[model samples]
Target: MKKLNESLEVERIYTVLEERIEQELEERIELGCWMYCKEFCIMYS
Candidate 1:
């Protein structure tokens, strides 16, 4: 079903992001709004 496929896709993206964050992020720190803002600034500026 379409709904089931959508659910699976969301799960897949979540898993990929979780693994990437675990592997690629700097020393374990909480993912807060400030961190996202800093990353956004770094990428755009």
Candidate 2:
């Protein structure tokens, strides 16, 4: 029973960490895309 509780807590912590990583990746991808677009516009003009 104690082991099960500990495992549950670990799983919850991992879930939160995974969510944060995904959010950060999404933000980085968006920033990268925006920068690429700006660069393209500058080159085109």
Candidate 3:
């Protein structure tokens, strides 16, 4: 029982960390795209 509980706790923490990493990647991609678009617009107009 103790071992099973420990495994579950580890899994939960891993899942949370994975989710946060994914969220950060998505935010960075969005920011990069926005910056690129702004630069393109300034260059054209």
Candidate 4:
């Protein structure tokens, strides 16, 4: 029973970390896309 409780806690921690990582990745992707688009416009124009 104790082992099961510990495993559940670990799983919860992982879930939180996963969510944080996903959010960070999304922000980074958006920033990268914006930078790319800006550069492309400058080059083409």
Q: In terms of TM-score, which candidate is strongest?
A: 2
Error of 3 at 17 (Å): 0.5
Q: For model 1, give the 10-residue run with minimal summed lDDT.
A: 24-33
Task: List the lowest-lDDT window of 10 residues for candidate 2.
Answer: 36-45
| Stretches > 4 Å off in candidate 2 | none
TM-score of each candidate structure, all chains considered together:
0.53, 0.94, 0.87, 0.94
Candidate 4, residue 34: Cα displacement in angstroms equals 0.3
Tens digit per residue, CA lDDT, model 3, 5-39: 99999999999999999999999999999999999
Q: What is the lDDT of candidate 3?
A: 1.00
Candidate 2, residues 1-45: lDDT per residue as tens digits?
A: 999999999999999999999999999999999999999999999
Clash count of each predicted structure: 0, 0, 0, 0
| Each model's lDDT | 0.84, 1.00, 1.00, 1.00
User: Per TM-score, what order, best first?
Assistant: 2, 4, 3, 1
**For model 1, what is the alpha-carbon lDDT of residue 40?**
96
lDDT of 1 by residue, 1-45 (tens): 999999999999999999988876644455566798899999999
- TM-score of candidate 1 relative to the true fold: 0.53
Q: TM-score of the candidate numbered 4?
A: 0.94
The residue ranges of model 1 lying beyond 4 angstroms of the native Cα positions read 26-45
Q: For model 1, name the residue pairs that clash.
A: none
